[model samples]
Target: MSRKTLIPIGPYHPLQEEPELFKLYCDGEIVTDIKWETGYNHRGIEKLSESKSYDQVFFLVERICGICSTSHPFAFANAVEEIVAVEITDRAKYIRSIIGELERIHSHLLWVGLAGHFLGYNTVFMWAWKYREPVLDLFEMITGNRNSYAMFKVGGVRRDIENSKIPAIRKEIAVIRKKIDLLTGAVMDDPVIHARTKGVGILTRQDIIDYGAVGPTARASGVDIDVRRDDPYAAYPLVNWKVITAQAGDVFAKAEVRLLEMYESASIIEQCIDALEKMKEGDITLKINEIPEGLGTGRAEAPRGEVFHFVVSDGSNSPARHKIRAPSYTNIATFKKSCIGQTIADATLSLAAVDPCYCCTERMAAAYDNSSGKKILNANELIALSLKRTSELRKSGTGHE
Candidate 1:
């Protein structure tokens, strides 16, 4: 007799607010097949961009994700500036690079905390978040905002780092570096962390390339593809740093890749600070007489992965067509392939291992109870029931999510 089981993961879970359904077909304790359903949060932002001007689109793209808000604007500005042939000042470029690195640091820390929370490690979650506060404070100190640091403008950045703030900025970075070192030790030395994550959700080198993975996901699988090095944008080429990579291709490897990347980002920030000190002041932005009809493409290394923005202008204030390729889109696609043959217990961690940004991925939908007239289960209740089913399926060692 052939036995089969079905398991549904979530449309809403504490770990992820985005609605994605994972259907796992299994026999006994092994997952036989996996299927994924997305498009729950399709906000039509890309289509909406067509109605907005290049300047206005910057703000629109910033709403793509709360975590990498600055990166979106930075990439969009670069694309627009390229179309107009605007040459931004060296000082502005260094400033942009510095803030970008700082964003990367905080983004990675945030991901680390989320990863801890998914694994039920509340202590690590709290500690990582507490440490992340300093980085946000540094951002608020510089740009006057904690989340949306609207520093980047059309021709150049909106504001420049003043001489008076130099010493304080340097001191803040020193403290951040110390915190990173301490966190690194805890991540590497923690026995529970390794037990739950080290060998879980292995994505081999070939699998990574076949699935078209990017950012830290691809890097963890030993793929040396970084837009910063491959396409040398902004001041990335001018600064010195190594592209961090790992050969393990597991959840632990991905975490290690991000952890080590913090050090590299710190070094890049230090380099930018030094470059800023030597840079001379000049016009931050160039005067654009007119915007001609042109198509421009801009790609940046977002904290999650690679972010691509394609803009086509028809000599009008608004773009004729604007397309945004978020990293989460591609990263989420790989979950179907990665989840097969794994236990349900590994489902949450594995899905989360890719460092998903559901807020960027899914659109909000009304939570409804589909149980019946007798009882209506909320979204959270449904998710909890699914978890219970997944546990039952895994008890036989033949389930996946």
Candidate 2:
């Protein structure tokens, strides 16, 4: 007879940054129940944003999620722009898109590497991370920081994509594009990986609709929605690109959508660069005075999904109320639908499928046994248990025990 046991992941695991705690209940090898807790870091960023001026909030929001550093600020900037009622220059628009696309490339590649690590595929992890370096290098060259690129401003972008650097950047993007194609081919062609990922954590299209899942998580489930395509902002409206989707709604489908989206991201960057050449250079930013009294809202397609920001201004430098909603908010909720009947092995990957900001998830989390109300395994033990499941699957040639 199988007995129910609880496994907890997070509140400061070595591999995680967000400090989340997941309570997974298992009977033998199958997951019978699941629960999640978040909000460990709780820096009060929204309330903190209320203290800062419109210009200062850009830097503040960038710190919300290191992985999603640009996305938050990007959305916040859009909100501020809406408040002021101004359009950025054509050059500024292209510059914004360039940075955004670069961020997406690096982010998706990093996710690929992490997913590989979870499956005990170190080679895939290495190759994916290797391709991600050039993207960070490009960020450093353009915005002075690899992690928090402080280029987003209220009126427009703070940095200009120079003509001299365009050739070098384009060459790097082309190189990265080639590597991405190779990686995508390798992942899709591998059979063992398919067994581990395909149909493992299936979130039905109905689950996505009910939970409001976004980004690749929703796209993988065949729900076609992208902020860039549906509601265009920055240079997204000007560029030629397509939103990628997959119908599987499993971990593999999530991976496929992200990998395919990389090509689109690279192409968008290329188009933006070409457009920049035709537009006036050094006109990347606009001048704006005091903010008016009104509500301003903005949304941007982050690497994970949609990043939304709502700001209310009352003729002051600081926002009267600032609300930020990361894609993972609704995305994480879908776990209740995807993880309930999965094996313990698939639970971690399913959560990772959302490409959540570890710190963001950890910012608010707690874990305990549902049966007895006692604290169970911590983050490291939970990870070990999940990895052990993969190891067993690899040796047995069957994912379920």
Top of the candidates by lDDT:
2
Model 1 per-residue lDDT tens digits across residues 92-177? 88888888889999999988888898889987789889999999999998899998887887778887787567788889889999
In model 1, the Cα lDDT at residue 191 comes to: 97
Q: Write the per-residue lDDT of candidate 2 for residues 1-401, one digit (tens) a residue.
A: 77899988776665454677788988977788888776576675776677678878998898888888889988998898898999988888888888888999999999999888878788988999998998999899888999999998988888887888989888988889889989999999999789899987899899999999899999999999999989899989887889899998889999999999999999999999888777767987778878899999999999999999999999988999998889888888888888878877788878777887745433322367899998786656755765786698779987523
Which regions of candidate 2 fall more than 4 Å away from where they truly are? 361-401
- What lDDT score goes with residue 80 in model 1? 76
Whole-model lDDT values for every prediction: 0.81, 0.85
Model 1 per-residue lDDT at 8? 71
Model 1 shows how many backbone clashes?
7
Residue pairs that clash (backbone atoms under 3 angstroms), model 1 = 28-398, 29-397, 29-398, 30-397, 30-398, 41-362, 41-363
TM-score of each: 0.86, 0.89
After TM-score superposition, the amount by which residue 83's alpha carbon in candidate 1 deviates from its true location, in angstroms, is 1.6
